[model samples]
Target: MEEEKYIGYIKYEGNLVEDGLMDARKQAQALLGFDSALRHFIGKRAPDFRNLDFEIPVRIRKGSWEALIPETVGGWVQGGLGIVATAYFTKAAQKMAEKDFSDFGITDLFKHAISAIQWFVRIGKHMGDTAIRSFENVQFLEGNTLVAIPNDSGEYLYVPKKMLDLYTSCNPKILEKIAENIEEGRELTIGTIVNGKVEEVAIYAEEKGIFCEEEAEPEEDVLFPELVHGDDVVLEGEVTRENKTSNSMGFKYEEHILTAYPESGSVVRYKPLLFLKCRLYGTVSRLDEKGSIAARRPKLYVSHLEPLESDREEDDLFR
Candidate 1:
């Protein structure tokens, strides 16, 4: 079956003021009002705006062209012209606002509506130099190709398919592991290479684990790591600590912590096993906030421990 696709949108709030003139408290209230009103209008929850402050010059540039209609026309004709002018100006304002907010990483159906209208207007006006200039100004708008995906934190992460492709290309091994785990029906988490180490971005599991509730379906052709979690894999690391204790019921248990320092050190907790001076292999069952495999309280459980030979030469060789 073909997978369903969606074009996501984010909510944006901005003060219509010049730079260095905003009252932060007032702006905050306005933003809150705008968000609330927008939610009521759309009948859905409002998405967050990018935290950066935005400033747009409040100047109105006048065009060289003058109205051709004669002033001798009756008030009724003038009234009709007034209505037309107001409608067009309102539309233009909306278009400009949408473009500005989308630039700051916020989008919504209303913004999309304005964007679509502007797109059509630009295409329709292609024969004119004015349209050409307008098109040029908006040609780089991200809404032309990008879509938003809300992560576990209720914050939308804009992921363009192109961006995802670039990330996957950087590490094909991670993608392969993800595919294998998907086929096996395991929980999935999104991770990326940070400083040559895998870092967790999103986690998706049903057992009240970390991260937000999964709402959207995963894209079939491209997997978003933030929307999915879990994959089986082997990791090699040094055993850092080991402990054995008995529960209140007198049931004995054992715990071991391993630290792997490939490019950077990552700690992993696993069940008791034979001690080896060399690194041991295990699957990543959970990850911490830093994207390293979680140790003390792991969501990604490591299993099937086995030791690997050390790369360092024995001291006896120098003797």
Candidate 2:
């Protein structure tokens, strides 16, 4: 309960805690979301948090439903790296020794990160069709641990590599359980607290885009055997499969089946054409080693997917 050692919290309020009571089962279920979200958040920003052997202890306090992460806990691993406060380490000293972070309290960096995410969540929740700059043009200055992100306005933003991973860390499906906590008659807020101030960003019941709906991590390399190299080929195909969990998909091309993976956010805009015929512009990235090294049973790294304007007549042919 020490304010100086207090790092962060996932505090819930509103209807769920109006009476200062929550069911044991519901509380445990809610902890599932807290577990994943907190670990994922910290693990991305600090790699050592994932490597720690013991579970990070988070004590839930009474009243408004608070799960506080104490920063004073020491974490020991197989390498005898007795790192304490694995989750609350600042970006300035994420990979460095504890002395690097001891100079200042954990308020500034921790507060800024939570505050920034809160700002982003608020913007994402209300963002409709308004266009924003995509990460496609973001060029970074290479680094061992940190990189500098360049904006179109010619300003350089220095960000740690682990922090940069946050951009690709979101999995919308992973949030369904968390979002369910806020029911029709209930209200909730998931936020970080520094010192004692809770963030103002709240996830409402009707919010749709709070969590970015993009493709999660994909597994293609290890799923199959070795894929022989092949030349780039542009082909028209029907997306036979689309997996929200992974970026990989089944593509039907000219009576031949191909494994297709979208580049960037191509699938997001072209979802309407998933089961229909579409023109694909991409390289035949990999070929089946079990078959001829030719384009037979190829795998595609698609950069563009265009739905065919003309036809539903031959749609059954792809089936």
Top of the candidates by lDDT = 2
lDDT per prediction?
Answer: 0.28, 0.52
What value does the lDDT take at residue 115 in candidate 2? 44
Q: Name model 1 segments beyond 4 Å from true.
A: 1-296, 299-319
**Number of the top TM-score candidate:** 2
Model 2 Cα lDDT, one tens digit per residue, 1-319? 7443445665566666866577777677667766666555545544555765445456787677766656553322212333454334445455346534444333333443454445345434433211232343445556446555443334555555544556445553444455556644455565665556655666654442234232233544333233335545667777755543455666776554566777665344444465667877776654446565544345778777666757654432322
lDDT of 1: 0.28
Model 2 lDDT on a 0 to 1 scale: 0.52
The collision pairs in model 2 are: none
